[model samples]
Target: MSRSVAGPEIERLIQLMARLPGLGPRSARRAALHLIKKRETLLGPLSDAMRVAAERVVVCRSCGNVDTSDPCTICTDAKRDPSLIVVVEDVSDLWALERSGAVPGRYHVLGGVLSPLDGVRPEHLNIEGLVSRASEPGVGEIILALNATVDGQTTAHYVTERLSHLPLKITRLAHGVPVGGELDYLDEGTLSAAIRSRTAF
Candidate 1:
């Protein structure tokens, strides 16, 4: 039988680290060793940061973004266009879009896509909150920036239907081949979207 190399406490830390996204057992072990070697500079600060985040982080009531405030920094930003709202799948997607700096409007995080096979339904998402926000005065448009998947499309349709009676104009992200991407390597759906959404050259 193989004997355990690290003490129980260290082994527990490695196990917990392995559970983090993009980390596996081997990588976690390496990370744990590195942290131990740099306990003062890395591990100590990381532990403190994690504790603070765990204690202070909250879901924004207005846009569903995760932050230290109920309304979140994005929702509270007066410079952003309150008339427009971009609906996304998750907090991660919200971060990605924010990094792009392409959107000057506020955002609404759905928390997840509609995946019936995965037991995720409309009720499981933040659809009602989105409807409520869209109904507010001064809101003019809602842009669905969901993924190019069947579930994403289904959720978009459902949201559009739910807000159909409202005065807001509902739109979706344009689908097409990405920049610097080759047509030969593009998927059929992307190629078709590119053809259909072709612009004046």
Candidate 2:
């Protein structure tokens, strides 16, 4: 009998792994078999790692980033430009920008964009935190690096309206970003070019 068919425990494991991003039921079964075959090499270590991460991982208090520390490494970094802050819809977008090595300023992740159709609103995002950051002394610029989607544009316009009274310079990523595309899918060169050519929105 197959390991998964042998017990409820193994079956449950396969079911859960199947739910992961790219893994389907067949792949999950194959992965479970592979992990069982190399139990010491993969399964044991993976279980331990997941447990540790689940216990230790927490949101960065200041920026809402997933990290072991409170403020996150970026927020605590003294070398990063505190005068400027690039706002991203997700941490994945932040990672994409970092991979390009084009942005010198610090980042603030919005977690997600405003999509009323999907039940997401301004209150669902980190707009209040962003406004507070903008009001901070020595902060000069706020760059919106949201995806070039309808909801993204709506969120950007909303943020701009909220911060209009602030003296900080507000800017958005350039139009080079393809419509309906995500920053996480863009190449480093493309992301760098878009950021360099950024204009007010």
Candidate 3:
């Protein structure tokens, strides 16, 4: 059995922080100590922010982006082009595209790719919502901006099949993405190039 070096509250904080992406046990401990050192300056503010986020953050109804609003800021932007909808595998991919500033349009997040091996299926994703959005007026193009993985490609193909009957063009990102690269890990230049060089699917 492991002995606690700190109180239960501090140990609990470390455990929860360790669960965050890119954070391990040692890193979480370091972070917790840092936060404790800066209790009034950082820890308090961070706790308040996290509380607000936990209480108010929501999944966007239109694009599946996590935000404080139902449609999200991207979906509600009137200046964005309604004719173009960039379909991504997750909200992380949507944020990556937004960081590139290459897409002047809205987005549709699929939540995840089709991974039959992992039991993920079409019904598990937001595909039905995407289909309904594509059928709406002013939606002229669908850009499948998914990662370059087997599951991503499979999801793209499935999405293409579903949207094939619509009176709109379907396109995909260029080969700037490596065979197994994810959008979130890519730099802005590569993502921008991929978006600019997208071709018909």
After aligning candidate 3 to the native by TM-score, how far in Å is the CA of 46 from where it should be? Answer: 0.5
TM-score of each: 0.95, 0.83, 0.86
The sequence of per-residue lDDT tens digits that candidate 2 reaches over residues 13-125 is: 88899999999988988898898999999999999999999999988767767778878888898888889999999988988998999888888889899999999988999
Write candidate 3's Cα lDDT for 9-98 as tens digits: 999999999899999989999999999999999999999999999999999998899999998998999999999999999888998899
Rank the candidate models, highest lDDT first: 1, 3, 2
* Model 2 vs truth, CA RMSD: 5.9
Give the distance in Å from residue 31's predicted Cα in candidate 3 to where it truly belongs. Answer: 0.9
Instruction: Kindly list the per-residue Cα lDDT of model 1 for residues 68-100, writing each as its tens digit.
Output: 998899999999999999999999999999999
In candidate 1, which residue pairs clash?
none
